[model samples]
Target: MSLEIRKIVSFEEETLIEGYKKADRPLRMFAVAAVVTNPWAGRFVHDLKPVVREYGPQLGELLTQRICELAGGAENIEAFGKAAVVGLNGEVEHASALIHTLHFGNFYREAVEAKSFLSFTNTRGPANAPISVPMMDKNDGGKRSHYLTLQFNIGDAPAADEIVVVLGGATGGRPHHRIGDRYQELQELGHDVDNPAAV
Candidate 1:
């Protein structure tokens, strides 16, 4: 089935100053959102896989393409994440159904050649709700410096019968990262940083 897309929203944010100092370079972030009709709103659906399978790839590809364009290219995306917001009439699972599938996430992952899974949030809310997209290093989940969040909202989205799916990216990590990575903390605790299983 073809997706019932209502609208697509694109956002970009750049941090040029950090901690009252000028950044050597801007830290760029991007997000692309698609507001689509919720197929199972206001009702319990025993099966979601059919819609998931049918819609995941298309949504994934469309959003990833916009992200790449906004970030200049997939290779420039150092951190990435996703989010979904279901309208009041829908379940949180309705939002998840569109984004949590491998069929949906793989497009962005493969495009950026990432090693870490895409971080995500699935929630239910009203129109114009805060859309939070949490991100981490595209290649390294333990990289504390690359943790990021993108926040934006649509004024009239997910109108009690819609879902908003989003994909987000960052050009690089924090402008001045003083804190070390997770590996350092792990090593301090006497865990084998190189061999996580041994810990």
Candidate 2:
């Protein structure tokens, strides 16, 4: 399957504080987005497995490289996530098929050296529908303070048969992270550090 990329977009945001809490340095976020033709649009395909398997890695690698570049390199990225929005003519599955695969996700994970799975959002929507990509600490998923979300939209994109794909990255977690880490919570709950269950 060939991906006909119509356009590529990048977004960057800076925050000096959140809710009266100020940080020593500004927090920065980066996201790279792609708008492309949906090969399976306007139809129902029961067997999407092969298509996803083949295309996931290709798109993943391409998007990952762009995001890493925008974030100033993979080494500087601390939190990461991905998202997809399918045009009005496509099914939600068409959006999900791109980002949910390991073939696609692992490139970003390995690049950032993050152990946690990439947080994500997938949906069907029209142009300029606020797209959001949720991020988490690359090395530790349970870090409350490291949780973040990057949101943006393209005024003229995803034209009913297209899809918008995004990859987001942060140089660091939230400033003044006082919420505490998840490993501490696990220890407090008397769960084994190696393998803990949700409480």
Candidate 3:
């Protein structure tokens, strides 16, 4: 079955000053979402394979392209993530199915030339629900400074039988990041920097 898309929304913001100080460089974050009709809503589907397979690539490619364009290009996106919010009538598993697959995530990963796995969140909510896509350094997950969350909401979306799929990106980390990275914290804690599990 073809995915029935209702509307597409884009969110963009640039932070020039933060924490009462001017940023070294303006930080920008972008996200794009698609509200689509849920094919399996209000029903129990033992196997979601067909739906997932059919929708993943299309949603991934569509959302990834929009988000990249919002960021000016994949090169400008240093941190990235994905999220999905299923309507109240649908199961959270539906949200997870669409975004957690390789078909969906590989597009963004390849586009950004990222080494790290795409961060994600999947949940169930109603229209105007808060959508938060948590991101991390495209190449370095341990880089705490690049940890970010792009937040937005569609005034009318994800109706009882709909799902909102999203992709997000950030140009840089928090403008006033001083806490250093995960590796540094490990070293300070006397843990092996190379092997975090070793004391």
- Give per-residue CA lDDT, model 3, range 40-149, as digits (tens): 99999999999889999999899988888888888999999999999999999999999999988899999999999989999899899999999999999999999999
Better of 1 and 2 by TM-score: 1
- Candidate 3 pairs with clashing backbones: none
- Candidate 3 yields a Cα-based lDDT of 0.93
Q: How many backbone clashes does candidate 3 have?
A: 0
Cα error of candidate 3 at position 33, Å = 0.4
lDDT of 1 by residue, 1-199 (tens): 5799989999998999999998888999889999999999889999999999999999999999999999988989999999999999999999999999999999999999999999999999999999999999999999998999899999998799999999999999999988989998888888899886676
Candidate 2 lDDT score at position 73: 81
lDDT of 2: 0.88
What lDDT would candidate 1 get against the real structure?
0.94
**TM-score pick, better of 2 and 3:** 3
Candidate 3, poorest ten consecutive residues by summed lDDT: 64-73
Off-target runs (Cα >4 Å) in candidate 2 are: none
lDDT for 188 in candidate 1 is 84
Error of 2 at 102 (Å): 2.0
